[model samples]
Target: MKTGKRYSEAAKLIEKTKTYDLEEAVALVKKTASAKFDETIEAHFRLGVDGRHADQQVRGAVVLPHGTGKTVKVLVFAKGNKVDEALAAGADYAGGDELVPKIQNEGWLDFDVVVATPDMMGVVGRLGRVLGPKGLMPNPKAGTVTMDVTKAINDIKAGKIEYRLDKSNIIHVPIGKASFTEEQLTDNFQTLIDAVVKAKPAAAKGQYIKSLVVASTMGPGVKLNVTKY
Candidate 1:
């Protein structure tokens, strides 16, 4: 594959076979960020579990200590006084059935996270076909589906992120932006890794975290040696 000159240069910084420690990996990721805009720093984990099996499914949420360095836009599905509660709690958009056609007809999905009250689930369920595929569906496990819209919105704004194994048994999530300090990124990284470790399914066997990689949005991946982690 033909790669850009900038990408090639960034790739050169990473040792193809060497696995770096968490600190070194984060530093390398930040150093290799060549984008003009603030690039997102992401952590990718290759897990051993098969996502196809219901018993081996690994998924959960964790709040980053330093936050993800991104302003999360939140949409709340609610009715009666709950709608007002959501907006007051820092929800970017809050409404009921009226917002349905706007999303279905206008293809309007301006928010990053979706939070719904227990009662508003019926109204929110109408958009399941559209939202489910996008990973925006509010699930109880991820703490997005709840009656406490305020806490949900606050947690989301505070950098709560969900991690789940994909078809390839890999989980990818952004830790923070390249513009953040190394210490800030490291804190978020540790928090996420700890959460992923604790969320291991009982049915999963063999190695849990097979491989770990950290990289900037436009940079090459730097492998992390988590054997000691």
Candidate 2:
């Protein structure tokens, strides 16, 4: 696919606007979204890094300001005390070994995220074939595997979106839909950007945030001027 000049321009702004506060950043982002563009704006985050560097690993979650514009079914892997916590925290599916067979047999990926407690990895482990290919595996490096069942479940229900750098060392995440107001999208966009920036590993060097673009589904990407942040 050909990357447009708009994408490159938006990327420049993303680099420039990195230092702005949430309030100021949102205001500027709104302006970018409202401006006339040569293409439609699909909401996506693009980050570039050198995947060869282990320290370049990027992981974290962010609650989109306007949600993901799609329903997210949350699946939690937990046992013992954490099971109740996960359920009470709003997990759609929270169980043990029994879920393994069901998930594997069904090969389900109806849920957008999978969270597992430290002890529950064993259960989730068996279903890797089912979930791994779908990108739903709960890996600790991605903050999906944790002992805090309640926090994990709640965050997912609250629209927490997680992303990791691909083989190309680029991470892309959806923040909202084209129908969302610019203000709402901007808020969600900034929140995710901040989280990703902070997730940079201390061992990582060079430019952690190579570029950023905010666009819509099947739309042209708008580069964010991020110098202020």
Candidate 3:
């Protein structure tokens, strides 16, 4: 793949062999971002666990103190009064049966997050194959499936994020935007790091956090010294 001129230039600024401390890595990522629009800063973690084992799965959610610097369009699956409650709480779309068909037939999935009430899980279950692969399925563990529709919608809009290891035992989370101050980004980074550390599975052995890297949307990745976190 051919690298763009901006990307090539950004790559030169990073030391390929050196792992930087959290603050230095965050500052470097912001400095290297040259995108015309506000670029997102993301943290990628490589965990020393087998993802295939059910006991070793690492998954949870957290609300970033500084938020994700993006508006989250939320869809709520609920019936009757709950629907109105969700919308009043700032949900982008709120419905029950009507939504399932639209998503299944028209394939209408324009929202960023999906929330469902416990009673609506039967309906939500039918769309699992559709929403599951997209990571849009409402799961209880992620707090997306619950009776408190209003609280869930508000939290999600407030930058609550779900993190889970992929097939490669790696989890990628957006800490904040490159436009955020180094201090703001650092706080978000620390919050996520603490959460991931606390979520370590008992089945996980060896180094829990194998490696970590932080980068802007269009910038080269800056490796972080895991021990410092």
Model 2 regions more than 4 Å off: 1-48, 226-229
lDDT for position 182 in model 3: 97
Tens digits of per-residue lDDT, candidate 3, 1-229, equal 4348889888888999999998889889998998888999999999999989999999999999989999999999999999999989999999999888899999998999999999999999999999999999998889999999888987888889999999999999999998899999999999998999999999999889999999998899999998864
Indicate the residue-level lDDT of 226 in model 2.
47
| Candidate 1 lDDT by residue in tens digits, 135-159 | 9989999999999899999999999
Error of 1 at 15 (Å): 0.9
Error of 3 at 93 (Å): 0.7
| Model 1 Cα shift for residue 73 (angstroms) | 0.7
Those runs of model 3 whose alpha carbons end farther than 4 Å from true positions after fitting are 1-3
Please give each candidate's TM-score: 0.97, 0.74, 0.97
Clashing pairs in 3: none
